[model samples]
Target: MKGLLLRWLILTLAILAAAYLIDGIAVAGFPSALAAAALLGILNALLRPLLLLLTLPLNILTLGLFTFVINALLLMMVSGVIGGLKIQGFGSALLASLVISLVSWLLTTLVGNEGKMDVIVLQRRDEDHWE
Candidate 1:
């Protein structure tokens, strides 16, 4: 549950970052960003799989790049439902989606599944063996 909340917060931050970086994406405030993130998460969990399966051929043809289009559509849908979030057009949604995904991915990587910062250190215990 804590991990879930952490992930949600990360996504909310990502949404805020997207709003900050993208010209056509507007988030009214932090509350709106939180709501948008939650809705986007729900939609991604509930609807994305079906959409992906339905568009498998196109997705395959584009070597999975079409997933970005699906993501953009979902972002647009979220904006439509969230009163405080606004996407000017499909192009804006696409760019915003890219930004959101990138930010979310980067933060999530830093905060691993356990909801803590993950760091790896490598040391050479011996010339022949490293651990």
Candidate 2:
């Protein structure tokens, strides 16, 4: 529980920093930033996977680039849900989403993993006879 909360806190800070970078992804202040983070998380959880699935053909057609547009749309939808958050237009949304993705990827890389969780073993270490 504590670890989960801590991870959420880290994510909140990342989102706040991202919103700072993007002009239209504003929150009134700290409180609003936190609220926006929560809203963003909820939307991503509930909507993102579905959107990805629905847009799979388009995503493949664009060699995965269309996923960026889908992500931007989700971010804009988040702004719609949260009062102080706003993404001006699709172009702004696309730019902001790219910025957010870059920042979040950097932060996640810096932080590393804190627990055992669900994920594919994309690469496996070579095995030996009890070595």
The number of the candidate with the highest TM-score is 1
lDDT of each structure? Answer: 0.92, 0.73
Q: 1-131, model 2: which lDDT tens digit per residue?
A: 76665556655676677678877666667776677767777778899899999989988999999978987887788778778777778887888778777776666666646733434445445663332
Model 2 stretches with alpha carbons more than 4 Å out: 115-131
Clashes of 2: 0
> Estimated TM-score per prediction?
0.89, 0.75
Cα displacement (angstroms), candidate 1, residue 129, comes to: 17
Writing each residue's lDDT as its tens digit, candidate 1 over 32-115 gives: 999999999999999999999999999999999899999999999999999999999999988988888899889988987787
Clashes of 1: 0
Clashing pairs in 2: none
- Name the top lDDT candidate: 1
